[model samples]
Target: MENLELSEGKEGLPYNLLAEKLVLGSILTIPQAIVLASEKLPIEAFYLQSHQIIYKALLLLYAEGKTIDYINLITWLQDNGLLMQIGGTQVLLDLLSQLNQSSNLEEYIALIYEKYIRRALIKLGEEMIESGYLTKIPLETIFTKLERKFFLIAEEKPMKYLVSVEEGLHQILQEIEEGLKLPQVPGLKTTFTDFDFMIQGFQKSDLVIIAGRPSMGKTAFAFTIARNVARNHGMGVIFFSLEMTRQQLLYRLLASEVEIPNTRLRSSKIKRTEWIKINAIINNLSELKFYIDDTPNLSIGEIKLKIKTLGIELSKQIGLVVIDYLQLLEGLKSTDNRVQEISKITRALKKLARELNLPIIVLSQLSRNVESRINKRPMLSDLRESGCISFSLTERTFESILSTRNSILSWNGSSLIREKITHFRITGRKPTYKVQTSLGWSLLISSHHKILTKKGWKRIDKLTLADLICFKLILLSHNKFSITWDKILKITYQDLVPVYDLEISQFSNYLTNHLIIHNSIEQDADIVIMLYRDEYYNKNTVEKDIIEIIVAKHRNGPVGSTKLKFDPKYLRFFNLKDSMKIV
Candidate 1:
């Protein structure tokens, strides 16, 4: 009966109080806790040690304001010399956590006082009891150690709580959503002519990917966008260039911006006028909001922290975030698998874009298989670990194929199909040509293109095998196509005649296999001779038609409709033109 009543009484003690006491008793070592309280730390968060230091530093700043600088703090520390051994700022934070647990400031202070004085006393008293020193020696010796512990606690300072995640998100989100509605940053531009039209703007916090093969100008394109966004738009852009340093990125930007040429930047051959332009550009750049972090192996966590810090420092705002390339990003923490790490990075970036509500532009490398394909142009599958990139994007996903070839079929011999945008065949000697349709340039290749363009040009003709092969060679020759084949053959009827010897059945095999009129590297082969050099295989050509094929795989767009441009080299197409004649 006595035991049961005792158990009931034990259960009645305040569980929260008990837990707090237990936690405080176990983790807060007497030696560590004593050193902190004595410092007189101002703030109250000790979970993170570095955070504690910042809190204490800020308290010092708040107390003295302009009178006390960081250097002053350091100098004071040097004079005291105790600062170096005060367990740094983190200990101060731990102490603050202990003190701030109480609702009332007085109660909190009392609690800290009790812990500083009483806890150490209890510990020493227990040790003395265990060693029989309490009875054998005088209490004065034990009080000395307790006194030392008390002094350390009194000297340490407290740490303040930084803003919580919820609060930070609330404030940042307001800024982000508002920034999106406003006009885009003044100077940011796009290398992709079509992307600029469709995207309308490169708004803040939007995570964009500029993916391509090794030589597809990923760096060039990113630099162009960064320069325009920062320099032209008067918007602050933070370019995290893991691959290049600030000076290198700046040099390339200057080279591209003023049209001075990259080779000149590499060498000392820059003219005086160039220097004048460069200096003026640099001065202009300084006025604009442009920042760069060339730190290599930057993790997504670090990137987020840096961006947050930047946003705090530059009161104006951060309009855009550009990662030189996506693959360079490390995971939040080191991981065993790179692919998994990449996925994590992409997901974080996408979340950041949505959270920040700003556009983020990232560059990525395509697979080497792209170089082996007849169409050197990149496909979604060609994207390195595209599964992660594709899955991460929630809103609009865009693929800008800036190839010399105008038509989709020509892009990869019609392996591409239009899902929404009626891919146009753009070809001509003119520097620029506008294919007018009701849909406008942005909507020309969109789903409504069939109704937008003339009805007669709606249906697309599949190219015959012979025509396809010949077209491939033409693109390869003009540097419009890329393939794995090292050797291209052009055979004439005379050459094939020896193999077939006038057998009609053998002709199909010859045509299907290696039959060609010319034999050499196809890239430099003359298209006219390969097509019309042999009369027997020649077909009378009335118009040099350029076909536009769309190879993009859109999650939501119609598929398979190749558009044709008649005599694209000369004739321009417009629905309201005076003449609809073919070129």
Candidate 2:
């Protein structure tokens, strides 16, 4: 009852007001005792309100390297107006009177932490049981949410100790010495020989992200790695199939293995010889320890639990984990928007990889920003920002307006009437799309490049006939301009050409060709792999069957590209060494 703040958390909350006081008293009594307490206990770990307040003041004084005696602490509290809130000097006097020798500071810190954990557990139980009455929340969601929380509490976290650098170096040296006795391949080996050599195998605790545009075969590529690593190394690989169902995924694998077309297998029109091959390969395929769960809209937390559960059930260590695509994975229910949700998802996946020591491959779609550039090849910048700029090839203009890099243009939403173009850039060759308006105007632009619309800025890829676009109206009578919206009539992809980007002195967007076009839009992925195929864009490319896997970001090794022969008939990727001449 004396320290009611500590004991008042719904009676029987399990708190030691005395332990909290002992720890705080040790810090206030023996200045050196804080050295251990600082590492072991945090301020809130103290249960008593007055103790937490007093501990906070002492820690502040210690951090500032000031004298942490009662005089300095009291002066600090009085100066900060916290001494009275914590019951003034009398509380400090009582703590000093009750505390034993500072030699017991470590145990006192441990006891304080133990009491805090107990209180947290009881509070958690109460919250969970009370939620049982909420009809609005789904039972499965509640369970998954609670499971993540409990896992985090029980997780083993390494504490920092004062070990010398020499001690760490010796352990690392020992590991290298042992590594030399093992096989040449350090991490798990894959089917792609060149890739393994460049990457030194998919190293453990690596979050490798594969990103590409639609129709680029990102999923097929990831499947290839998952299957190859699992089969070649004899280790379990778990695939989180968010987009495709389990059957659909395996069908592609089977088609690739038997050298038969997926269409032929699905229609049951396969030749008798092909059927024999399929039956022959089914047993070998089943023997490989590849696991798949086709759960749609799965959160990162659920994936963790599933992979861990499967690993335990099979009594195997999971070598590789694949998430079909980053965008599809669901995040926790919060007020965060799509961008923030995606950020959380990627961060959580990276953390999960480190926790499980499993190499994770997450597939992602490069943002539309990549389309505006003629290069079309995604830089780390394409993922930076979305929904900006229009690389209009047709360059249609009203009143035959003439403007150059330094030309002045109408500045929207600014006090100034016009702004000069500080600079311009020639974006590499890309297929431009033509958008026609009801006003008999047409402009060629990149497919995914965004332009200002009545609804706000939107990607051209999402535009339809119903949408209205912003355009400048030249007022010849007064030699001025006015802005208005016009309905979109037609849109089509045009031929490839170099695009232009302008830098306005004051704003990001500028008026071009009588249209108020908008301008502008980064990855934390450890390793990034991008997919590209010449045949997707060109009908008569010399290497029609080649798929280029670009190692965009390799944290531990050199970044480069490797060619894999794309067998479209079977939806398979074969190494160049095994395939026909690429040149």
Candidate 3:
């Protein structure tokens, strides 16, 4: 037998024979080896011999499009009398994976030049020493030059930002000018009414956190979003579903996108019609750009590397990334507490968003405290682990928060708007039953300051008692305030004159002047106002719940309701016009 050189795996000396074979065969690319052993190899297992064979086989198979199936691979090795091979087919499989997932060839080259090239040169120097061909002095000079080149690439290349400074300013202006423009792609819409109004729809490079308690459609929502981005916008989307397998995620996506109902899809029960629907939808989906990876217990670094590769493969046209949830993600480095791990994870995600220039939608789990509350509406403070992740890295953090909150409230435009915009005191010192805005006004309180009037202070209840009664009737009779005065009073002038002190003339003036009721004269007359709901009143109390005008924040005009008629459903608060016919 020809003697094969072997060295004991030792402290400083490499397994020279394996390194020589690797360099001579050109079997393994640096990226292939790095990717393969990055996760699986133990500290002691990642030796020169093990990685060498793994890299070479993968490089060959990837380049040639040949496959080494399990049985065939085993038999071939046995025929080569290498059945006892230490770095067997398992190692080779990892190598093949790296090749399949090869993205960022430039980055890989840079990484290789930095990490392995010098080491390769060092190995070459050692070989020179052994072979007695080249001297040690020239090797050192070559190694130094190579090291300089590595640092030059590292220092010169700037990592991509989420938005370039000029582009960021332009984007902010565009967001302000257009509010949130829908993607130019047609037929895409958002399910959440409030979110739709606020964002128009999701934008690229946005790191949106959609968190809820378990089984609150986190995965389902992400799947919906991914489908929308991929199918509608013709944008590439990568979903890293750590909790579910690729097939399971694909099934959920197919069910959601095609409206097959999750149960039918999961049970594999398909009628002829349903199968036709699935086939047609699948064919449509085939035209979309979508990818899924079901790598469980994936670390953040691994995810970043994968995304980087994906960005490269897609020619930097990656539109979105969806991580199922934050807490499930692991960090490359180990930490004692989960909070720290999550903090790291979030930071990495933010970095990934910046790096890839795509919207990264990460699902999160709110604490059980969310469930414990009587109302499960989520607040920004309720965000898990890292509170800072909720805030954007803009110069005006408070301004942006207030602006977004104000926008949501302005669109709501009801008794709820005031309550929604206010920061609630979550201190638990106050009664849980009581609701107050951070501005210290009770949501239950009527707009009029009645106690002062009873104390002989100057009356500020601009409307008389009869007008107040009519306003209450309008608020109670209709779910909205967008009804005309003629519809609201219903009773004739004869009925009003007998019991009430208010005249029709005075009532109209009070509505127009004091209450700020607006009208539309487009067709038949209609009325709209932002009066307090009947729920505000105690029913037993002497004081009735009344509408109040409180300004939040207005960019275009002065902030405040101006006592305009408003509809909670249509969410339109405006002056009554004769033309305010329902469209």
Leading candidate by lDDT: 2
Ranking by lDDT: 2, 3, 1
Candidate 1: where are CA atoms >4 Å away? 1-193, 203-205, 386-583
Candidate 1: tens digits of C-alpha lDDT, residues 1-583: 0011111113232112322232232223232332233243233313223334433443333323223333444454456554556566454445435532222332333344343344445555566566554566667545544444443443233444347999999998998888788655322354333333334456444455666555334565466567666765676788899988888877766665566766677787888777888888778667867888998877665676688789988876788888877777755545443443565567667767766666777776655555455544444444444222111100111122213232111122322222222222222111111122222211111111111011111201111112222211223444453322111121111100100011110001111111111111111101100001111122353423422222232112222213233222122221222211211
Ten residues in sequence with the least summed lDDT for candidate 2: 384-393
User: Scored by CA lDDT, what does every candidate get?
Assistant: 0.41, 0.71, 0.43
Give candidate 3's error at residue 547 in angstroms.
28
lDDT score, residue 305, model 2? 82
- TM-score per prediction, in order, is 0.39, 0.68, 0.39
Candidate 3 to truth, TM: 0.39
Better lDDT candidate (1, 2): 2
